[model samples]
Target chain A: MQEVLRAHLEQIIPLTDEEFTFIESHFILKKYKKHQFLIQEGMPVKYVYFVVSGLLKLIHTDDTGKQQIISFAMEDWWESDYQAFYTQTEATFSLDCIEDSVVLGLSLESYQTLCEHLPKMEHFFLQKANRGYMALQRRLLSLMTSQAKERYQQLIHQYPTLVQRVPKTLLASYLGVSRETLSRLSFGV
Target chain B: MQEVLRAHLEQIIPLTDEEFTFIESHFILKKYKKHQFLIQEGMPVKYVYFVVSGLLKLIHTDDTGKQQIISFAMEDWWESDYQAFYTQTEATFSLDCIEDSVVLGLSLESYQTLCEHLPKMEHFFLQKANRGYMALQRRLLSLMTSQAKERYQQLIHQYPTLVQRVPKTLLASYLGVSRETLSRLSFGV
Candidate 1:
């Protein structure tokens, strides 16, 4: 699990063994069963998780209890109610497992400490944040420009693995389409 | 203009005079009138801009020449075809002034040099990126969950100044509604 983290970090910034050890100290490993909640809505978001195995969804539940999957995270991905985590506020979104999962969790304090102690980690995180920002920008643009069926096709074309793994209902929510509409489209596709 | 950039950077990280000078040297200031294009679709993106004054819109034009606004930027904000700028690819979106604008343009090479030479800049950029990601996430969620009327209300409530500054057609484009609908809604409000 730690090796997975090391490799993920190395993808952006090479880490020395000693540096990796120090970095690893800031994170605690945790495991969850499918459907177990990592961060619950309205509760304090304590840590941001880096997935080691399995899959998770960042979910937003509306006033009527309609749950929407904002995004998904699998192995090598980072998941959090980020606005809440960064601001130390109550989680607006809940994170839960789509499969039995293992993750390395880092608290806000630990994240700040790590960056302060090793500026290289700041560089690493900046790279990650920039990439994440770019992704969100693309997603926002897609939402603004594309129709539901087009978005579904775009998702399938770009993330065939994710499309295969995510349940249709959740995918429908993510794509802003009705379940029946998604069903018809998926059947046709 | 340089002071505006310095003040924006200082909001995240303190910079010495020497440090600010070093940072300023990497940016080139340019002015554009309303409707002038800072970036055009399919052109190689050369710089990521930090707005010193006035407003800009990031726009996407579909095959039929219909345009949709992806986002807007004002004084103290940053705007770019970031996907293109970062990847060194031709821009899929165009950025143009909505108001007579002044911006500091930082080339990718200069960006790299700034981050490498002054790691604080990386931290500053990380903070900005995180905030941008959160904003995009909120926008995406709103697009998924809200009706056009509700989104228009939310925008008016959240960004009153922007609502006042932007034209109805662009606002309608941003809200994914027809101009007539937006005009009716605005008149009622």
Candidate 2:
């Protein structure tokens, strides 16, 4: 499990055995059953989770009780209500396991301490944040310009495994289309 | 103009005069008239601009030649085809001035050297990137869950001055609504 995290970090920055050991000490490992909530809307977000295995979805429920899929995270990916986690505020979104999942969680204090103690970790995180920002920017552009069918095709092209793993209804919600529309589009393709 | 850059940096991390001077030396100041392109689509993105005065719009043109407004950057904000800037690729988006604008431009090499030589600068940039990511996440959620009128309202509430500054058609483009729809929404409000 720890090796999963070490490998993720080392992708952006080289880490020594000692440094990886130091970094690993700050994380607490936990497991959840499918459909269990890692973060509940309106509850304080205590930690950010890095998945070692399995999958999760980040969801926002609007005032009218319509649920929107913000994103999905699988193995080696990080998931959190990041605004809530960073600001120590209550989560406006929820994160739930799509599969039986194991994750390494890091508290805000521990995150700050890790960066303070090891500057390279800060650099590594910065790179991750930049990449995340770029991904979201692309999503925003797609939302602004692409039709539902086009978005579905783009998603499938970008993440064929994700298209296969995610349920059709959830995929529809993520693509901002009706399940009927998604079915038609998928069939048409 | 350099003071604007210094103040922006100091918002996240305080710097010594000598350090500020060193950082300022890496950026070049340039001015552009309204409608001038800071970055052209399919051209190599050379610099990320920090707005000292006036406003700029980042735009994406679809294959059908429909233009979508990605975002607007004004005083104290940084704008670029960041995907291209960081990766050193040709820009898929173009940035153009909405008003005669003065900006300080930082090349990728200077950006990297600044981060490598100053760990605190890296921390500052990490904070900025995290904030940018959070902002984009909120926009994505808005795009997913909100009605066009609701999105228009949210934009007005968040950036009232921006609404007043940007043209109605561009504002409509940013909100993913037609110009007539925006006018109706604005009038209704």
Candidate 3:
């Protein structure tokens, strides 16, 4: 589990053994059964989790209980109510495991302590944040400009693992299209 | 001018006198007349500019020369070809002064030197980048989910000064709507 986390970190930033040890100590490993909620909407989110294995979905539900998938977390991906985590607000989205999963979780307090003690870690984290921004920017642009078919094509191209693992209906929600629309786009249209 | 710049810095992170002096020395004051390009597309972007006064537009043009406005900068705002500035790639967008302006420009080399020398300054910049990501995320959501009218309303509510300073057509482009659509949205249904 530590090796998986360390590999992801090393891909972005070369960290010293001491820095790696600091990160390892803060993370708590846990398991979740399929369809379990890691976070729920309107609750105060205290922890951010990284998927060590299995799958999770970050989603928002409307007044009528229709869900909109915001993001998917596969192995080695980070999942959190970022706004709630940063601002101490109630979460607007819930994070749920779609499959039985192992996760490494860290509380907000411990993350802050990590930043305070290891400034270089903050730099490393910021680099990852920049890459996240780049990915989000591309997703946004595609959402704004692409047709349903185009979006489906791009999604398959970009997240082949996600397409293979998650249901088509959930993928349609993430793409902001109707399941029927996605069906046509995928099969017929 | 220095006082105004110092005030901007204080808004994000309080800079010590020595740190302020260190940054001030690295910034060069640049002036641009209305209608002149500050950073042109296809060129290597060497500097990121902070608006001291007046307005600037970041624009990307289509194959037939139809312009899409990416963002606008006003007083105290920072503007750059972020993809180019960060990666040292050829700029994909052109930045033009919408009005006569004075800007504090930092070359990539100077900015790197400052970040290397001042760790706090590096954190300060990283925080700004995080905020940029947050803002852009909100913008993307707004663009994807909201109608043009809602987008225009949100824009004016957040940056009324921009409505007064920027032209209607550019604002339309920025909102991802036709000029006619913007006019109707602004005037009626």
Candidate 4:
């Protein structure tokens, strides 16, 4: 699991053995059962989790109690109620495991201190943030322009494993389509 | 214009006169008339722009040739065909002026060199990217959950001046509403 974390970090920036040791000190590994909440709406977001195994969903529920999936995280991906995490405010979103999961959680203080200790880590996180921003931009554009069928197809093309791993109902929510429509699309009806 | 850029940077990280001078040197100042293209589809994205004054729209045209407004960038905002800018690839989106505009453009090479020269700038950019990502999360969630009218109202509440400044047609396009529907919503019918 620690090797997973080190490998993910090394994908962006090469890490010395000592540097990896220092970075590893900042994170705590946690295991969660399926459907376990890593973050709850209205609680302070304590850590940004990097998934070492299994899958997680970050969701926002509206006033009518309808849940909209904002994003899904799997191996090597990061998840959090990011605005709350960054601002030290109450979370407006919740993160829950879709499967029994293992993740490395890094608190905001450790993130900042580690960045200060290693400017290279700051660069690594910067790249990660930029990539997240880019992915969101693409998603926003897709939502604005593409139909649900196209979105699902694009998703399948991009992450066939994700399509296979996630349940059809959750995939429907993520694509903002009804389960019936998703089933039709999935079955090529 | 340089002072405006300096002030924006200072909002995140304090800087000395010498530091500002070094930072300012990496950017090129340019002015565009309304409807002028800052970036064109299929062209390489040369820089990411920070608006000093006026407004721009980042647009994506679908296969059917209908344009989608990805976002509006007004004073003090940053806008670009970001994926293309970061990856040094041909742009799929076009950035054009909505009003006569002044912007400071930073090329990728300059950005990397600047961050390397001043590690604080790396932190500054990281903060900016995180904020962008957080904002996008809110937007994606809204797109999934909110009606066009609610989205329009949210936009008005967030940026009253922006609502007033932008044309209604573009606003309709941005909100993904028909112009007539937007007019009715605007009139509170």
- Fnat (0 to 1) per candidate: 0.90, 1.00, 0.21, 1.00
Candidate 1 lDDT over residue span B21-87, tens digit each: 9999999989999999999999999999999999999999987788888899998889898889999
In model 1, the Cα lDDT at residue B135 comes to: 89
Q: Which lDDT values do the candidates have, in the order given?
A: 0.92, 0.94, 0.83, 0.94
Query: Chain A of candidate 1 scores what in TM-score?
Result: 0.96
User: Can you tell me which runs of candidate 3 are displaced by over 4 Å?
Assistant: A62-66, A180-189, B63-65
lDDT, residue B150, model 4 = 94
Query: For candidate 3, lDDT tens digit of each residue in A102-137?
Result: 999989888777766877666666776767776776
How well does candidate 2 score on lDDT at residue A159? Answer: 89
Those runs of model 2 whose alpha carbons end farther than 4 Å from true positions after fitting are none
Q: Of the candidates numbered 1 and 2, which has the greater lDDT value?
A: 2
lDDT per residue for candidate 1 within A92-151, as digits (tens), equals 999999899999999999999998899899998988898898888888878877878888
Question: Candidate 4 clashing pairs?
Answer: none
lDDT of 2 by residue, B1-189 (tens): 889889899999999999999999999999999999999999999999999999999999999999988999999888999999999999999999999999999999999999999889889889989999999999999888889999999998989999999999899999988999999999999
Using DockQ, rank the candidates from best to worst. 4, 2, 1, 3
TM, every model: 0.97, 0.98, 0.88, 0.98
**Candidate 2 Cα lDDT to native:** 0.94
DockQ of candidate 3 compared with the true complex: 0.42
Q: Is the docking of candidate 4 incorrect, acceptable, medium or high quality?
A: high
- Local accuracy of candidate 2 as per-residue lDDT tens digits, A150-173: 999999998898899999999999
